[model samples]
Target: MTGNRTHLLLYAVEDLRKPLIQQLLAYPQINYSFADTPSELLFQIAQQPPLLIFCRTTERSRVPTSTPLIILCPTHEYHPAQFIHEPAIVDIVAETDLMRLPFIVLRELREEHAIVRETHRLRTLVEHTPYGVIEVEIDSRQIRWSNKAMHHLFGYSAGEMQNLHIEDLHPNDIHTTIINAFQQMSSGDETPLIHITCLHQDRSTFFAILHRAELTGTGKRSSSSFLPMLLVNTKVSAPCKSMPTGSNSPCARLIKDCTISISAVVGQL
Candidate 1:
């Protein structure tokens, strides 16, 4: 097998039929190994874990709980309800439907690849974005992650920011207000775009607009969910003297521009 091909492990007490073996081998993108016993299977996994595992229903218990699996059952014996508690089982197929195996594997691989690509694309966007973004653990109110732009905006290194609480980024005078806002968000209240003062590492303060959104799946807030805040600095030097009479101040213009830009970005996300 070449280094780039997907590796699969097949565990069965009895040999798979010749047709099934040939079906899997026909896919050039896949390379596979067979093991009749649990110990041999585990040894192979220890050396180099396969991307996915194919196992007989009888041998399902022997497969590692962390690995994804496709279970093969005797014809007319497949029961979907029986594997409801087993999160590791991706799909269950009857022995007679072995022809579907290759298609299933390819479908899974394609989906996995798409997820990887999307994750990479998002990470790159975050790293390069001009807007400061920070992710806070909803339950603990601790700073969990931030991008380079975020670090630069607050004048703190990535290491220092990791140890600071979410409150540390704001001035002490408004800590109470910030806490109240967070409580409301946690309680599922509709929060308007927040305008607040933010503190930098040097203790200098600046005006900013804060936009908050949940970072996890839809539903009630959970411990695993994150509160991601997009910070846009609206601080500007005294209104530009070059402006025409009664025109909006630079700060107002900047805030309006930021609000529109952030709304568009959030919509895409």
Candidate 2:
């Protein structure tokens, strides 16, 4: 199989009709291979994973976890309930609808390509941005996700930061302030941009501007819960001439503009 063409695997397809064969062969960009037995199919899959698999409904249980599959069911045996809960099954078609295979394959390929492009775009933006981004669980206060810029700002390697809590990034004197801010934000109160002292992995202190926004979960908590997340953005700044007495203090001037800019960027993500 050539790298330029999308490869498809056909497993245990008995009595292949001429029209079905012709329909598959019609696409120049698609290359296909057949596997007669379960062992042969698994061996071929392990050797070179196919873009999609075309398998008989009876053999659907043999399909690997997370591998995209299109079930070929006989017209009389078709039932939507069997495949509805399976994430891997993209679509099901009756044996008489063999000609529609190429169209389904092409559509799935386009969607997969589009997702790859969008993921790359977001990763590029996150890595190149000036501010260090950190995502923390609001309840546990643990660090969940962070960007490369965060590693640079905090003097911590990627693995070192994973086990840290939000309080660990600040000095002992400011733990109360940080906890109060978190509580206020959780209660749906507006948290204005503020200047604070932050600690590096080596325990050195520096002045930085901090902003956070709540990220709510879209799906149920059982499957995956991104809810109650605090998306924190920080940028190192020069020492303030005078400490911030309040939100309207002189030190606020240093980070006033960042409030709107960071919020806009996070909103887009």
- Count the clashes in each prediction: 0, 1
Give the whole-model CA lDDT for all candidates, comma-separated. 0.72, 0.68
Q: Estimate each model's TM-score.
A: 0.64, 0.60
lDDT of 2 by residue, 76-182 (tens): 98886888888899989888888889898888878777657655665565555566766666677677767777888888877787798777888999988877776
lDDT per residue as tens, model 1, 1-269: 44644467888735675766778767877767777787888888888887788988878888889899999988888888999998898888788888888887888888777657655665566656687878887777888888888898899988888898788998898888877787676667644333477888999877666655443222233344677766777555222345432227544455456545644553464
Itemize residue pairs with steric clashes in candidate 2.
Answer: 217-227
Q: After superposition, how far is residue 220 of candidate 1 from its true place, in Å?
A: 14
Q: What is the lDDT of residue 193 in candidate 1?
A: 35
Model 1 has an lDDT value of 0.72
